[model samples]
Target: MALWIYRRLPGAGAAPRPVHLAHRIGGAVLLVLSLPIAYHCITAYGVQMDSARVALHSLAGCFFYGAFAAKVLIVRSRHLPGWALPLAGGTLVTLIAILWSSAALWQLAQP
Candidate 1:
């Protein structure tokens, strides 16, 4: 969050790139890290459509991937409007926040 905000400062105009290679690498690492958890959840729960928590996690994971793809696309596409980068980044942040609150926090609260 701070990184994104920092990049938005008035002086940041000199560098038009929204994300560094490191940021993209970190996101790739996170995506890889999530795969095991997702696999375990699917193998264990088997997509419980009747369970909102499970369904939400599943949906959020799906959206996370989509957001990630969009972020990458936005980062690489020069023809997009200036707002596109921030919007893509914000969507990713929102999805991660939702996933954290819904899944990570829920797991922590469990006995």
Candidate 2:
């Protein structure tokens, strides 16, 4: 759907049936995956930037939550311009990839 939205511009193509399903399911997954990590981060350090990794992770987490909320609004609200939903969804996805790369993959590479 993101690709389609970009290719078509102005969200001209109707999202396929599966795109709706994927958006809903993927959104749920992202929400579930984010919660505990967010809880741990906020409880453990309270959004400190004492180190580069911690800072980036904390900032990215903030952006992730913001994007998540925006995406949900995009899904629910009809008043937004057509390009908004896909653009929001894509931003969320790109942020997730960056977070995963910087945090998860970085940890795996450490030892």
As a whole number from 0 to 100, the lDDT of residue 82 in candidate 2 is 88
> What is candidate 1's lDDT per residue for 1-111, written digit by digit as tens?
325544656565433354555566777898899889878877887666677877777788778888888988887899999888889888888888988888889999999
What TM-score, over all chains together, does every model reach?
Answer: 0.73, 0.73
Residue 60 in candidate 2 has what lDDT?
84
Q: Which stretches of candidate 1 lie over 4 Å from their true place?
A: 1-6, 9-19
lDDT of 2 by residue, 45-73 (tens): 78878888778777888898999888888
Off by over 4 Å in 2: 1-19
Give the CA lDDT, 0 to 100, for residue 5 in model 2: 32
Cα RMSD (angstroms) for every candidate in the order listed: 3.6, 3.8
Residue 5 of candidate 1: its Cα lDDT? 42
